[model samples]
Target: MKRPLLKIGELANLANVSQDTLRFYEKHGLMRPSARSEAGYRLYSAQDLQRIRFILSAKEVGFTLKEIEELLALEVTRDEKSCQDVKSLVDEKLATVTQRIHELQRIKKSLQSLSDACCGGDEPATHCTILEALSDHDAGSSLVGGKHHDLIK
Candidate 1:
């Protein structure tokens, strides 16, 4: 049975990505056209469609293009160790995400303390405690650590 080859536009439509996206993937060596028409149009096979889906799914899960490339390479050489390699990559990403969450939480707490210190008055900002704390180096350091609630008072 002959497999049907799809033009670039057709594949893009099926994959819900722009033609430029396909080109970019090609440029990045993440994907390749199965063949080219005599008219110079890029053509793809069903296997290409599956590969595009895999790329998109990995992206949705926060994998960078570099990481996705590693994953694709792993897929091509599957063995008993492949699962362990993938798990290690995911665990690294999870640790990074967890660290970022902690940093953001600390930032949020600092901002909340600054907001709570302010009276929200309509008066001029010349004597605002929030502004004053921001200008003071010691207070600013405390705010960054989220331990300056008492200092603001």
Candidate 2:
């Protein structure tokens, strides 16, 4: 026999989320309890716990709630086309992460150059090369050999 449905508190404890967060998920259409008790308490199944775990996992992987919703929708359909769609979304996310990594690398190198320029011998702030580079309009262009906007944006 299957386990009986769990009330909100029980599900929250099992799922490791607060009852308010569960209600928030429900309000946001991310999830809903499987049923309600006669006294109007929310009730959930084991499947709901699984769904909450999936939601948390997706979030940890940097998926936006909107993206997670799309993933969940695709999962519910469980069709070949949906699998292809989900793969495409994953590819897009990977590309975005790659681009962000590249951007961060550029920023790191630029900041490193500024740090290198500073002698760090208790020089006055006015004479600090790091501060000078930050204040100067053409700093990144000279230090990193990239345009200012390239380093920052």
Candidate 3:
């Protein structure tokens, strides 16, 4: 512990996060109270600042709050294998991202074909290829398949 631990506002500023974010992290169990001043203000140690930095970095790489919380929980428990678990979680996230990219490509191709068939400015509504493609289909009809439609929804 260091002398004169920082107050909540000072800690938030040092962490480059808002006071609200600090509160949210506490609520989510990612952060814990260090100590309290005589008037009931929260105090944070040097270790708390380091933890906040780690959390923000993780978030920037697409780790959700829950994921960060899991990591924090592991740290709290002094789990030796937590580093391995982090790598696993990152690999899983990368796979999900790749899948999403492929799905987006499919949706883009579908929309392009339909849209290219109709000139945006000159086409009459009834004769519009986009309109025809859409209107000709029944309920649940889309140029794109169900998976891409589900994404749009």
Number of the top-ranking candidate, with TM-score as the measure: 2
Greater TM-score among 2 and 3 belongs to: 2
Instruction: Tell me the lDDT of model 3 at 5.
Output: 86
| TM values, all candidates | 0.52, 0.54, 0.50
Task: Tell me the lDDT of candidate 1.
Answer: 0.76
Which residue segments of model 1 deviate by more than 4 Å?
A: 75-153
Decide which is better by lDDT, 2 or 3: 2
Residue pairs of candidate 1 with colliding backbone atoms: none
Q: In candidate 1, what are the lDDT values of residues 18-135, reduced to their tens digit?
A: 9999999999999999999898889899999999999998788577988788767754235766778777876786786686676666555556656665577454443345445444
In model 3, which regions exceed 4 Å deviation? 75-153
Task: Please state the error at residue 121 of candidate 2 in Å.
Answer: 28
Candidate of highest lDDT: 1
Residue-wise lDDT of candidate 3 within 7-78, one digit each (tens)?
889998898899999998889788975888799888898998999999999788677999778666643225
Q: Looking at candidate 1, what is the lDDT of residue 153?
A: 40
Scored by CA lDDT, what does every candidate get?
0.76, 0.74, 0.72
Clashes of 3: 0
